[model samples]
Target: MTSELIAALRARLGDERVSTAESVREQHSHGEGHHAPSMPAAVVFAQSTDDVAQTLALCNAHRVPLAAFGAGTSLEGHVNPPEGGISLDLSRMTELLSVNPQDMDCRVQAGITRQALNQILRDTGLFFPVDPGGEATIGGMCATRASGTAAVRYGTIRENVLGLTAVLADGRVMRTGGRVRKSATGYDLTHLLIGSEGTLGVITEIQLRLHPIPETIAAAVVQFETLSDAVATAIDILQFGVPIGRLELLDEVQMDASIRYSGLTGLRALPTLFLEFVGGPEAVREQIAVVEAIVSDRGGLGFDWHTDPDQRAALWRARHHAYWACLAYRPGYSAMTTDAIVPISVLAELVAGVKEDIAESGLTAPIVGHVGDGNFHTIILVPPTPEGLAQAWALDRKIVRRALALGGSCSGEHGIGLGKREFMADEHDPVALEVMRGFKKTMDPNGILNPGKML
Candidate 1:
């Protein structure tokens, strides 16, 4: 059955598009996350929506699962083909279809990464702001509903993706939403597929909303005596409507790792708050003043602000390289990153409790987060030994459980691939899960679309 499916895929997509080589299969196996790798039987480097539809059609006919592989940056095993069928690589379908600068929107194929799209739009004075750190494909970002530093101000991929073209499980092509900003339409299918991971369908093209470049932008780095102080100041700034473009938290451990990894810094490696305020020059200055007062009151130390673009970029550069930095902190160790988000009110408590828990476990898990939105990540590093792996997994579960208990989600941006599926029952009601199952069954009766994921 698999051989026939591969033959059909190659015939339709051309021999160059289909590969059964061990190296290619290994590359499509897993992403940056800690999930065990599962190599697909074959990989199809789809070059167009037609190619995707044809492959899906063949896979559906043969009852072979199809998993969409983008930049392979998903940390939740979303790109891995656990059931082992065909991995649809979408990197080649990167065509900028249309750009409507007046509408502040553009249409592009899903294979384009966020950084690449922004580069193409640089001349237009508009930018796509959903920066999930990694150079993730727009399609995968939509699949996981990804958000990053700028999400606090510009919103997430869910808000930026106005419309998209998707190929259903049975090879039917459908479009959801449009260039218009608002619509009181029935069932929000656009949003339905936003965070569906890959269990729903394959997103082919995307119409994205863009934001005008800020007139003036400035970044600041402030150190706090304690984690509570840093989080307190961040929460207070948000309450006062400072209009911060981004606000990130890095515990001492993460700060140290980032400093060592990125090099060139006068930072004190204490619990730090990385902030960016965006607006006109005067407004930004005013915002910084107010934030400074709040930080001072909250016992924040070394409040350093920089308006130089290079300096601001350098700060965020270090922040974006957090995963690698954390990994480098403990060489030769695998990391099980956790993405637990809580209400701003309870964020401090969550971090504090998790810190204590980590200390008790005697683990080296550096912490970093987009604290403006109460979302944080812990890179739990473990030796390759079985005992070490078990301990790391235990700590990950403890963090997720704590977040759930505090009225937060087990995952904020990373979708429920294989890593967080166990927490779905605790997070969602049985009725809600059943409804989700109904949708899955309705859309993919044969279970041939990214099986062994989400529901």
Candidate 2:
């Protein structure tokens, strides 16, 4: 049966596009997560939306599972093909279909990487702002509803995506939403598919909203003696309307790891807040003043501000590399990073508790987050030993439970994928899970579209 399906796909897309080779199947089997790799039966490189539709049609007929593959940067097991069916690699479909600079939006094929899209928009004075650290495909970002430091100001992929063209499980092509900024449409299928993790449908094309390049941008690094102090200062700055483009918090352990990994000197190994302001020169200066005042009031020390593009990029690059730095602390051990968001009012307590939890667990994990949006991440290095894995899993669950207790989610940007599926029933009520299952069944009756993902 598998051979017949592969033969049919080869006939439709040519042998060059379809591959049952061991190497290709193994390459598409896993993502960056901690899950053990499992090879898919075959891999299909789709060149167009029509190709995706046809592939889905064939898979639907054969009852073969179909999994969408992007850059494979998923922190959870989002790209894993658990059922060992056909993995659809979308890299070949990369294309910037059209750019409407006047309307501040662009149409792009699902496989276009954020870096590539931003490069194409360099001369247009507009760029996409959703950066998930790694160069992830726009389709995967939309699928996971990804966000990053810029999310506080620009929102996540969910808000930036204006519309999407998707292929349903039944191989029907459907368009959701429109180019307009606002809509009161019936079902909001665009949002439904945004964070579906490719379980409901396969996104083929995306219309994304872009932001104009700011005239002046500045970044500031402020160090504090305590995590509570840093969190309190960040909350105060937000409350004072600082117009911060990006506000992130990194504990002393994370700062130390970053300094060692990047070989930087003169950085204090203390809890810190990394902030960026984007606007006119005057506005940026005003925002900086507000932030400085708040930090000073909260016992922050040595406020260093960088306005030069190169210097600012260097600082953010170090910040973005925090995860890698954390991993370097424990060589030969894989890192398990988890993100959670809490209310701004309780952020200080939450961060403080997390720091204590890590200390109690006797684990050397670094903490960082987009504090402006009340979201944070804990990067813990997990040894390959069975005991180490068990301890890491327990810590992950504990953090999720704590976040939920404090009116936050188990995951802020990372989707459920395979990692957090067990927490779905705990995060959402039974009724809510039922509603999600209803949507899943409605869109994928055969359960062949990334089965075992999310719900």
Which digits, one per residue and each the tens of the lDDT, describe model 1 over residues 1-455?
Answer: 99999998877878999999999999999998878899899999988888989999999999998899999999888888988999999999889999999999999998999899989999999999999988899999999999999999988888898898999999999999999998998888999999998788999999999999999998999998888888899899999988899999999999999999998378878999999998899999999999989998899886888889999888989999999898898899988889999999999899999999999989899999999999999989898799999999899999999999999999999889888888899988999999999999999999998898987
Could you tell me every candidate's TM-score relative to the true structure?
A: 0.99, 0.98
Off by over 4 Å in 2: none
lDDT top scorer: 1
| Candidate 2: tens digits of C-alpha lDDT, residues 107-223 | 999999998999999999999999897779999999999999899899999999989999999889999998999999798999999999999999999999999999999988888
Q: All candidates' lDDT scores?
A: 0.91, 0.90
Candidate 2 achieves a global lDDT of 0.90
RMSD to the hidden true structure, all candidates: 0.9, 1.1
Q: Residue 356: error of model 1 in Å?
A: 0.4
